[model samples]
Target: MSAQSTATERRRIAISALARELDGSNPASSAARLSEMLDTPRQMIVSADIDGLVSAAMLASVAPSWNVVGLVASSSKWLLHPSVSNEPPAGLVAVDLFSLNHDSISNHVVKYGAKRPMLLNLRAEWQAWDAAVAVAAQKRLFAVPSIWAGTQGCYDDAAKADSSKWKYPLGTAQILLALLEAADRPPKFFDRHYLPWLVANCDGGVSTYTKYAANARVWWAVMAGAVGPASLTEQVFRLVDGMRPHDFLDTVNALDRERQASGLDPWLNDDWNLANSQATTIERCLRWLADLTGWRDPLLGGIDSFAGWVEKPVKASGAVYIGGANVTTKSTEAAAVASLQGARSALNANFYHGGFSGSRFNWIGGW
Candidate 1:
């Protein structure tokens, strides 16, 4: 078949699947939830060539609202932008980061750059936030402050008492400090706690799943080469796994049967359950498939590393020699020296800042 014909067929299938999902029994559930209800075999339903489908616009953004939820709730927002732009625009383009990848961000900076390009990051960990800030700083890009709530102790009342307060855990505080250091200019930094206030007072609508998925698609597309195919698949699988419930699959199948039997195209069908499920399912499937197939990762890359960094040594120093004689130095020595140095630095830094000396090392110093 010709490429055009194949594209048409694929879209028909997508439309059929979506129609089935919308015709399900529930009116309140989203597509991700409906798919769980239908017991749609994940492997069977999930397009094997997801990246290609996304690129060709066979699957597109269904809602902007849900995308927003996924972005704000997750720990890593790095991939959010591309996910947004998976579908081609129907009308005038809006302000969004989904179509831009790291390289694209660079190109934009080189081309038509804004004073502060909005950066929507979902990293909940302090270190990840810091790393993102560091990159932003290196590029001299302005950050549109976003809520990253996934970090440990991130939601503490004291940590969130003031928007500017540094009372958060070391990792969280470090990220803020990094942002300040990088921008060489302080842009507004808001934690998750401060987000409700910011959004309530701001003029724009909140981010939604549809918007997030669209942007996420864009993000994945832009970073396709960087993330590779395997890694992308794993990420997509994780995304689907995270969003899908057990009942969604069964619900979708039942709904689809109903729609076809009624001679209704799901998107245009009057059935409330079918419409709702179809919309929800399409959105969830598109988002998951985009992430899984667009980016690739080698399997050998340690899955445990997804948890974040550890101080594992790359190589042992073989042996140490003292006075021309080999002397065995305990492996714990390195750890001890690091701890002692860290403590000393904390004390000295705290004294210089006129804060309580013990506060800096509270978790480590046993104070």
Candidate 2:
């Protein structure tokens, strides 16, 4: 295949593996779940193209029983495999596709003699949110997606009835506030795009999954001493310094090996619990080691600053902020301009005082 095709396949494999890891489900188990739910022989349908093969492989990673059938481009139909010709597959699962199109998707049930077809919308939901806002703002923009929780749903019903009402650990806001406050100028996307998105998302009216995860990652990152680029650079060094601790180094190496073995992207894209735990443990261990070695935070008492920032609601101009810059759109609902843009301007003023340089550090996507 072509180089681009190979790279795309690799990325697809990594994302499927990452999804399994995040949901704590293996292919056999996920297939078993589907089998129990649908009681059908799972077969994944795809076009005979290279991208279709990648999708088939990703689906097979999640649904082990899934047999792949490539629909021929010339005929617009699949050549029925001999093995299951008589009985036929029960259900066809479509992967890496969102919209309903193509004969492989549109005619799968009739063509394949399947009961129903399932679409594994594995693409991150924040993509939808960003697209929505981009359309609203009339701009061509891409958003950095989140890895803070399970990617299945828009919101965890058990966690909170309304997404807007969710509460975060204290001092979470302080980290972001600190980053914005520390910047030499307004962040590139702050005034024009990001600020507006943040205000609209955090208002709690919509079930924007990545918004919460983004907030959590930032909170944990700050707690782990990554307030901004300066500290982020330092945090990397500290993580490397962790090599001296045999236990921690071994665990890190083990995780690295696991990802390599599973053909997953060696990045923090799975399990927010693990990410949070590792950050918390690493910070504590590093702090203890620093005390012994006469190392101290040059920025000073970041944890304290975090605590101070989230202690009370912050106000500037007409906007009020709480729980890590999440604003309540409830009070501002009546006045659209005053509520959205006003809050956006206020946030811009708060976070964009100093100038910023370079791109935002998207943990998963990278800068």
Candidate 3:
């Protein structure tokens, strides 16, 4: 077989192997399997994008012994958020990351309240410091990195390096000084100082890290746009529009294998971020594959067919705004019926029961 054919065969076999690992039967075993895949602590913390976030919640659910704290937008508004509902599906606690004042966070850290705190997005610098201080105060609280910071290669060096062992003491010191001189530390400092150390220490250097981060940005944008502002979402889709199909598929396939092994569902679910992320990725991969083979997605047609194929579905797939809901059924037909009934039940129960709802339904054959 040719090189291309051999690669394709390898990917197919890999995907099948991964699907078994992701069978969703035992989450603890799946998490253990996932832990083996990460070479660095940063990967554990930074890589939890959409599917990663879902897998974290799953592992927390199955392993109740490990305390999982979810950092949300607010301490006061969290109860109002749908996350207060049963969607996390287990003993995961959602807390306002900002709730603990400086004193409270310090006190909480000393107590080591949460075992592993999961920060899905670190939009600003202070958030990173907040996570670091919380985790550093207690070694048991795993130091998790941000999706952008971890995957981007900026934080990987510090994350992977043993602070006790100093290879380039001078360089490290300079970076530290730069970090302290907030104004002098340009955004590029991360790209310049830390990326070199990461490349020198890790397997893949800046180029490899760049490719991964770019792909992750695309996946994140899709999930974020599902509940976030449209303008921000549109900008992210445009960011990776020019990425080669082969490269994009390679990343998706790699992630799919890992996600499945982690016991993340591949189907699209309205409530599950991991499932929705997988579904959207699958759609994007299929669209790219079609274009590479000179086949147009009949659903999308335009002058720049490839661009049309890429942009339309990404925007449309996540456009249907819906709140989080936990759903399970034996098949797609059952899912459809259950979802419809659940919506109606929720509405009626809310109207009659004063904004509170409960559901217990039976399917055909008592499934």
Candidate 4:
């Protein structure tokens, strides 16, 4: 099917509009503006991660006309992705792309030279609120800040973005869920299965899960009629609490059912499960390590332990490394150094950044 553009489409809603809409006491912004953008027919480019996958699926379930064109984690992939790079359709929109200090506008969107791209980005929800605004201001894009809580949507300038206004740690998926509630279309199931993997991928473990789990519950509550504009934190834990995964597709079988029921389009024309989806840093690093150093270790308690073991090689030519779940960029760097210095076993070191995964290394580079 060919892409079509609407002649009379309005630009993206203002941050002030979202700020008011999300505010509980003064619910000034009508759902029309936000809903208009949501209901716009388009092909979507989604982040190749849990939150992005969940956001797109939920969107398709609600806006039956939209299509998903690609699942990419990096900006270069966003441009060269086979589904979009060669003959991209019109009305292309990118949703929830991870910002590992990536300037997508300068990188690809500006040079796209097709129809303007619509973006729903919340990377500023990390800390650099002004950075997000900068991306939205480019001439070649139709941008709206998708942030909900911290930074109160955005800061007008860079100087004010000093620190975060976060009351609790949360993900962009929850923010989208809240906005969906405002749009009066709520997804059926806020997944629960692969929620742990995000934390594991972050090396934050269950504690990271504990910190942000309530954000999912907040979305569920909005669906249940709590309100729009998700709050920052939960002062106390209710019995019901939260552990929902914004991600869908628990299994290959379950994905089939979800698509049939939700009428969701294919993910970059492919189907996958929790194990080896979203060819991001975690998977890329794993493959690179295997090729570079040939790690054959099993889960040795955790990755920190693995890192520790790799750091101190006792006159051994080949150090046995462990792998489980953890990351500290410094530790990873040190271990990479150890791999060369102590063992001289590996030919080279492969570096990776863990920012996009919502890990402790948010926006920071590492080995």
Top candidate by TM-score: 4
Model 1 lDDT tens row, 1-367: 2323333333333233223322224342122232232222110001112121222121112211111101111111111122222322221111111111111100001111111212212111223423443453343222112212111122211223211111111111112212222222222222222222221111111122123342223222222222234432223323332443432333345545755796754531221111232223334433333343332211111122222312121111111111112211354335423432343211011101113221111101100
Poorest 10 consecutive residues of model 4 by lDDT? 105-114
Worst 10 residues of 3 by lDDT: 314-323
Task: Please list the residue runs of candidate 2 whose C-alpha ends up more than 4 Å from where it truly belongs after superposition.
Answer: 1-40, 70-77, 82-90, 96-367
lDDT per residue (tens digit) for residues 303-366 in model 2: 2221221111122233222112332234433342233233321111111111233111010000
Candidate 4 runs further than 4 Å off: 1-19, 23-32, 73-83, 87-90, 98-162, 165-168, 190-274, 277-367
The residue-level lDDT of candidate 1 at 195 comes to: 20
Give the per-residue lDDT digits (tens) of candidate 3, residues 55-81: 222223223232222211111111111
Please give, for residues 1-367, the per-residue lDDT of candidate 4 as tens digits: 1101210110111233344554434433333344565566666655545445545555666775665554443322331223343443444555554221221101001111111112212121222333433453342232222222222212211222211211112333444545555556654443333222321222222233355442323222332243433322211112124424533224335545655686644332222323333343323333322232222311122222322221111122222121115422334545433432332121111112123332121121111
Question: Candidate 3 clash total?
Answer: 1
Q: Any idea what lDDT model 2 has?
A: 0.26
Question: Between 1 and 3, whose TM-score is larger?
Answer: 3
In angstroms, give how far residue 304 of model 3 lies from its true place: 44
* CA RMSD (A), model 3: 23.6
Badly placed stretches (over 4 Å) of model 3 are 1-49, 61-136, 145-367
Cα shift from native, residue 137, model 4 (Å)? 6.3
Ranking by TM-score: 4, 3, 2, 1
lDDT (0-100) at residue 343 of candidate 4? 20
Against the true structure, what is each candidate's TM-score? Answer: 0.18, 0.20, 0.21, 0.40
